[model samples]
Every structure is written in structure tokens, then in C-alpha cells.
Target: MNINGDYHVHTAFCPHGSNDKIEAYIEQAITKGLTELSFTEHAPLPKSFSDPTPDKDSAMKWADLDQYIQTIEKVKKDYQSQLKINLGFELDYIEGYESAITSFLNDYGSVIDDSILSVHMLKTNMDDYVCVDFSVEEFARIIQLFGSVEAVYDRYYQTLEKAIVADLGPYKPNRIGHLTLIHKYQRKYAVDQGYQFTIERLLDIMKKNKLELDVNTAGLYKEECLELYPPQAIVDLASQKGIPLKPGSDSHTAKTIARGFNKLSLLTNN
Candidate 1:
């Protein structure tokens, strides 16, 4: 696969990611023969939302927002001749925080070159939530709260569907990230339900909305999920519908850029 760009990448700004410099990531992309890369660092959560994970490092600090952009701007100027660098954020789509998200986009969206809307935190109750892929213990707790592996999967798809159709102003990200992130630990808590109908519904809505699919490769490295997000079968279905499938490494470290490019059969076929 002649991969040209990686649309979803984290940076030193991410609290949960490595402290590798932004320049290092750009150098890695250039070394891997990628012409373009987007630093989709996790945006700060809404003020009303509380961090549920143990360490509470799922996203970046609000105080660092400006510096994050400025740092990127500096690196972008330096690497302009060598690579096409994009400034972006991986915004979370918490179900009840639409207004906050909209306000945020309105304030900063003008400068963003590319971005992604993703669902990392799942609401289990009116106020309580859980970070879906935080840890295996957390996944177990999520199953206990939702009552089963099936219910958790159902809620994830349902939330993703809502995210696809929700109105978050003009700055809303065009890419729907990691469509099957809930399967990150499927080997341990595998469910019997196929969720074919729900998956198809999501694809249909994505097609209608003209949203891009982030065919994330991070799941392939997860010990439990030895396949692509949405897997190949679902990838084929998206291809049949003519949805744009862009590969993303979801790399937390600079060395991980284009980590699984060869596994992208859709890119190869094209």
C-alpha cells in the first residue's frame, strides 16, 4: 500500500502518550516515506465533564491549548519543505456536551487544518462514565455496569451513531475515528451478537453525512484485537458503499507512525 498520510496521530501534548518531541514525529513520518501527517492530539474535555480514569490523563490540560498550537506552528514552518504537516485535534464526542464542543470549535476551529471526532468516554448513567479502552479492569467494570459485553457494544455503536448525526457547528471534525474501538479487548470478553444491523446503520449515516472513516491500525497491536477497527469484513462493506477510508496509525509515540500500513488492503486494492 502506497500510504501517503496518517490522519490520526497523537503528540507530546497528550497526557497519556509519550513525551517524544513533535519534531521527532515529523521526522519519523518523513523517514517512513509519508508525504503528510496530522497531529490529532486529544483536545481537553468539557469543563462540566469529569475525568473517570484512575490517573485522569485521558486528554490534555486546558492551560496547554495555546502552547500546543504554537508549538505545532513552529514545527510546521520548519518542516514545510520536507513534509505537509496539519494542525488538528482529536475531539471527544461526549453525548451531553454538544454545546461546549460547539463553542470550542467556534473559538478555535478556524485555525485547525484537519481534525477527528471520536468517542473515548462512554456514559453509563446520568453523570457517571467510563473510559472504554483505559484498561482491562475498566473494561470489566464497564461490562458490569452495562450488564454484559453485548450491552456495552450496543451502547458504543449507539453513541457513535449519535456522534455521526449530531450538530457541533462548522468546526466539527469530518472523520469518524476507530469505529470498532470497543473491540479492543474482544479476546477476553467476546460477545455472541454480531451487531450487523447497527454497524450497517452507522455506515449509512456516515455515507449520508459524508464523514470519512479513520481506519485505525492501533487495534491490530492490541493483544486482544488482532484485526483492523471494523475489521476487513466491515471495511469491505464500507468500500461497497464508496465511503472514503483513510488509514491512521493512532500512534502515541513517534516511532509508531505508519506502524501497520501494510495491513491496509483497501489502500492496496485502490
Candidate 2:
């Protein structure tokens, strides 16, 4: 598995991730023989929106964006000779806040070397955003609100389709993060339909837009998912379609720098 770079990684700035410093992650990446590492901490959210998680601290403070950028820039310089460090943010795609997100990206996107555009939250009938991967209880709540698991899947994929077409100026992310993140708890609450149509639509959109797919391995380590995100079949299809696939650890801690990368290599090889 000659995985050279990891594009999706979080740091202490991300409240949901470990408190480890960027240096710790850089060291770990060096140990794993990764040539490039990108610090893609979760992008700050708007004040009007609130996450429905129990902790309510999934993202960094909006004011801290400058500090986050400065820190990563310094680290990138410090390790310029040893490893390649790219600066970016894992921006979430919320339905109604496209303009706000685009504005933010326009301001900071120029400095970003790489980024992952992800759909982590969906709007409920109540007009509030709720996390799709927070917990099984939350997922069930969403399913109940939508009247069924398939309906939730429909909404999720629909939001992703919008994300694919969103305009974030010239700095729009070139990669889609964790294409099947909504399936984090598939083992607990299975959907009857295969979602092949949705997958095909997403792939087609990516192909047309020249967007890449994040072949994230984080799902394989999750207790419920127990499979690589997008699964093997999707990867094979993307390969056939010539949609570029970029492997990401989606690391929340220094210890998880390259988790499941070997499995990804094996899967892609076969």
C-alpha cells in the first residue's frame, strides 16, 4: 500500500478531535512513511446555526480561523524538508447556508492548498440542522422524523448532490469527503434500497465537475459501519468511471494517522 498522502485530518482545533498538536500528527505521518499530510480541521460554522450534538462543540470558533491558519502555516514551514503539509478545512455543506459557506471559502480559500467538501448535517422538518453521523440515537431520530430510513438516505444524497454543484469561487474544494458518511450506522439501521441511482448521480456529477472522491477509511474503524466508506463496489464503479479517488484517514487523532490505509490499498488492488 504505497499511500503517499492523507488529505482529511483533524486537530485539537476541532473540538470533536483529539487535543494533540499538529506536530504530533506530523511525526506520526513521518513514522507511517506518508509523504504528504493535510491539516483539514473542521471549518467553523455560522453563529445562527447550532449543532444538535450533546457536546455542542463539533467545530472550532469562527474567530479562531486565523489562529488555525497561522498554526498550520508555521508547521508547514517547520516540516517543509521532512514532509509536505497542506492547509485546508473540512467544510460542511448545510442546505440553506450555501452563500455563507461560499463567502467564507472566498475569504480563506485562497490560502488553502487542499480541502474536502462534506455534507455532515441535514435540515429537518423543524428547520434545524442535525448531525447525520453523531450517534445511532440521532440517526434513528432523523429516520423517524423523515418517516423512514430510505427517506433519510434520499435527503442525504440530495444534499450531497447540491454540495457537488455549489460554487465556492475558484477555491471550491476539488474533493468530496466520505461519500457515504450517512451510512456510519448502517449495521444498526439498515436501508432496504441499494442507493445505486443516487451513487450513479453523484459519480456523474463528480465526473462532469472534475471533482475527486475521498476514499476515507474512517468508517472501517467505526463499530457500526465496519466497512470502508462508499464500500468496495462504489470504489470499483468510480474506478471504471475514471473519477479520481483520494485516500484519507479522516484522522481525529495523531494515533489514527493512517488507520485502515492497508485495507484501502488491498481493496483497490483487487
lDDT of 1 by residue, 5-123 (tens): 99899998899999998988999999999999999999999988898899999998999999999998888899999999999999999988899999999999988999999988888
Total residue pair clashes for candidate 1: 0
Q: Would you estimate the TM-scores of all the predictions?
A: 0.97, 0.95
Which ten residues in a row are the worst by lDDT in model 1?
A: 261-270
Candidate-wise lDDT, in order? 0.90, 0.87
Candidate 2 per-residue lDDT over residues 1-270, each given as its tens digit: 237888889999988778898899999999999999989888998667777777797788888889999999999999999999999999888889888888888888779999989998898888887888888987888898899998898889999999999886788889999999988999998999898888988899999999888998999989999988889789878877888888899998999998888777543321
Model 1: lDDT of residue 20: 94
RMSD for all candidates, in order, please. 1.5, 2.0
Candidate 1 Cα outliers beyond 4 Å, as residue runs: 266-270
In model 2, pairs of residues that clash are none
Global CA lDDT of candidate 1, please? Answer: 0.90
